[model samples]
Target: MPTVDAVVRCPIAPTFRVSQLAGMFDLPPEPHTERRFQVELPGLDQPWQVGLIVGPSGSGKTTVAAAAYGRRLRKRLRWRRDRAVVDGFDRRLSTRAITQALVACGLGSPPAWCRPYHTLSTGEQFRADLARGLVSPGKLLVLDEFTSVVDRPAARLACHAVRRALDRQTFAKRLIAVTCHEDVARWLRPDWVLRMPEGTLTRRCLRRPRLRLEIFRCRHDVWPLFAPHHYLTGKLNHAARCYAGLVDGELATFAATLNHFRPDRLRISRLVTLPKFQGVGLGGAMLDGMGSLLSEAGAESITINAGHPAVIGHCNRSAKWEFRRLYKTGRKPSGMYLQHPHWKTSAGRAVATFRWKFS
Candidate 1:
């Protein structure tokens, strides 16, 4: 149980206003010329994955963290303004490796990867920063002001994504998040917590709150709310049945099912999970639940076509879904194109098809 101590001193000019302000308010004058902080942290004897330094603002959290892990503490990241978000990563990291990090960190949209960091939303930028830093060779990462710039929901989901990513990685890495907001601790569920200013430390295994998503059939009017987040941007199909999944009264997933080739054969035509909620399996749940609905409604066959590797991988591992076929997407033969007569072409793309049934 090594203890770390930090002293913060601000040179005072001792002006007239300073002297008067000290007497009236906590203006830092007269008897109080310096602030001292003492923090006790666990030594390297035990294994730990995550740690949190949390308290109110100006509570000496940063000072304590810097004293303990100065080398890992970084105030800001320099992202290239002229480069895309994926291009801003280290040259040693392959595009696939960088995109994997981004996906694991909850910034999974392919379009966002091509856009510069400045063009991303605040939440997206936060995840991108995490992804870039997480791929580093360093064993330790010190994050200050964690999730401070994003909304509460984004903060919570980002915490979950970070926890999942760290747990899945092979590297024996550790992360220490320094933040003023204490709410994220619930989602983050760090291995230990150090409350600043007073320097209180607690070590315990904390469980993340289990989230339940209630999926239900919904009207297409809700599609607009989720349209922007979909990988393929398009209007909801009028002939398709739409379903919505809600978590704590907030919509988190969307799916549109259609017959496509035959009215009796069902297919999940469009599936989208809000980026923040992607890794949580909501999209797959929406697909399965909607497929079961149609199955119960007398549909003879059910299928799903997926292009994303993650989704395809999930379906491959699931017992409920069986691999069907792979489509070589491109401009089809003129004779074949005449049969479908689709306006847009998916040239040079590969899509995996799967059939859904009771496991």
Candidate 2:
């Protein structure tokens, strides 16, 4: 649920066409960087405020989207561009609402009304992140590796959902999806298709992406511990209380407490995955799981201060979260990494913060 203004804008935009993209990718014919191809896009006559960039892995799909959006943010010699602005947002509100906002951004549908991101399937998080990109009005939505984790059926369903959402939009919104999957072309039914092979780009008319349905049930009483623990600990920013994924009624992994504290508008003070579940997905899951709940609580959005790309990816991808550029921390940051400064000695810390949200 970040403010629209906070989303990073690329520094420049390029007038990309199939030929230019193809040349840059070095498809079949090798061309010098300066020898740009006269671009040809038969389908694109009018200006495409929104666009889709399709390519395989290592084909620079993200690079293209990034470049396009950068240009969209820039003021040209003839075109007057307005500075992007966003409304006020807080990262501490309801998680569900945040999930909705993320979905609006193009991440995916929020988890169940109350379930946090930690409890969601990985594919669900992908959709949530897609939704997040879509929330901002008039911004182009770009998704790389658009549907890798999901089975074909689920991917199709997700594609259809997004297509429906975009097709029904009141304002102008663009979508860009990157994938090596040839089948995606058919399922997504995109207005434009840019195919990349061996680092070269080309155009193709293929089938759209497919839609699929999938479901999983909690094997135990897993939903009752999150907010309860937050309330008990008096740390409203606490992200989650459980670590182990449930297999039937037995705990398949270790248990731990995960929490985060936003000391300022720009940084998080405490982010701990605890000891037992240190290397597991607990910390990341908590952030993802709590996203929806935080949004529902009335926060405009959520933010995380993380350096580890893995953790960042968890929030940005596994949980469908976005990030601002890394803010430089002046002092040695404490809280989640080491000991939480808020801990008023051992007495308060001993209360295992391992609570659940399902109840």
Candidate 3:
């Protein structure tokens, strides 16, 4: 067994306004205080993967983690205001690795990756930070105030994504999350949990909550909420049926399915998972669910037109979907062009199109 001890102390000003206010409340006007963090491990047989320190504000979570790990603990990610999310990672890592890391952290949108870090939403920025942290070379990664800024659902999904990413790492690295939110404990499933204030430490056998997804028909007006996340520019098809996938009553994925020119064929034109909920298989699940629904409704087959490589790859691997063809610029494919004709690649060439048929 290994033991660790940490002690933190700081001086306070007795003559300050805070002290005067404390006097009015009949509280102690102490000039200094000390906090201790002591722990003993049961055995050195198994390697620790994740350590969590949770408590409310001013509970000394940061101080204890810093004292215990010191320079080995990476607390804050270095960020450039104008740099793209992909460019913020370590230069030594390959582009593929960086992209995988970003996607693993739930920032999977192509448009989101190209934008400057400062332009990202609060949730996107949080995931970007986690992505960078996950790829950086470090043995002890300490994330202070984990999920403190995002809403509860985003935080939970982020925790799940990060945990899965960490599990897939080929190297030996330990993660320590210092947070006030205990709701993520189930998703994080940390090997060790250190509770501040009470100073309680426990080894947990946590299981991830089964995500209950509810797919329901939604109106076309819901398109605006998910349109910004889509890589291509387009308006919703007038004849399309929009569907939303909700997890715990929160919107997680959206899709637009429209009937093809032939009465027996249906095509999925738009499929998008919200930024916070990406990389969780929600988009694929929604597509499959909607396809099954239409198939049972007498539709012979369903088709999907996708430009993203990730979506294309997923379709190529699924047994229910078959790759129809790939079309480049200046070429007309067999099926009708669901995407706008004006949508071209940066090089003025037609973007690579991947078509899949699902039954």
Report the number of the highest-lDDT candidate: 1
Residue range 92-126, candidate 3, lDDT tens digits? 99887787777777888988888889899888989
lDDT (Cα, 0-100) at 145 in candidate 2: 68
For all the candidates, what are their Cα RMSDs to the real structure?
3.0, 17.4, 4.4
TM-score rank, highest first?
1, 3, 2
CA lDDT of each prediction against the hidden true structure = 0.80, 0.41, 0.76
Clashing pairs in 1: 330-347
Candidate 2: global Cα-lDDT?
0.41
Order of candidates by lDDT, top first? 1, 3, 2
Give candidate 2's total backbone clashes: 78
Listed per model in order, the count of residue pairs whose N, CA or C atoms clash below 3 Å is 1, 78, 0
Instruction: Name model 3 segments beyond 4 Å from true.
Output: 11-33, 41-45, 167-173, 309-319, 322-359
lDDT of 1 by residue, 168-226 (tens): 76335788889999999988889899997779999975788777878788998999877
On TM-score, the leading prediction is: 1
User: What TM-score, to 2 decimals, does candidate 3 have?
Assistant: 0.81
In model 2, which range of ten residues has the least summed lDDT?
76-85
> Residue 81 of model 2: what lDDT?
24
Model 2 ranges with Cα > 4 A deviation: 1-50, 70-113, 170-172, 198-359
* Per-residue lDDT over 93-209 for candidate 2, one digit per residue giving the tens place of the 0 to 100 score: 344444444433333211121345444455554554454455544556556667777777556556655654455462256666766666655556676555443333344434543
lDDT of 3: 0.76
Summed over model 1, clashes come to 1
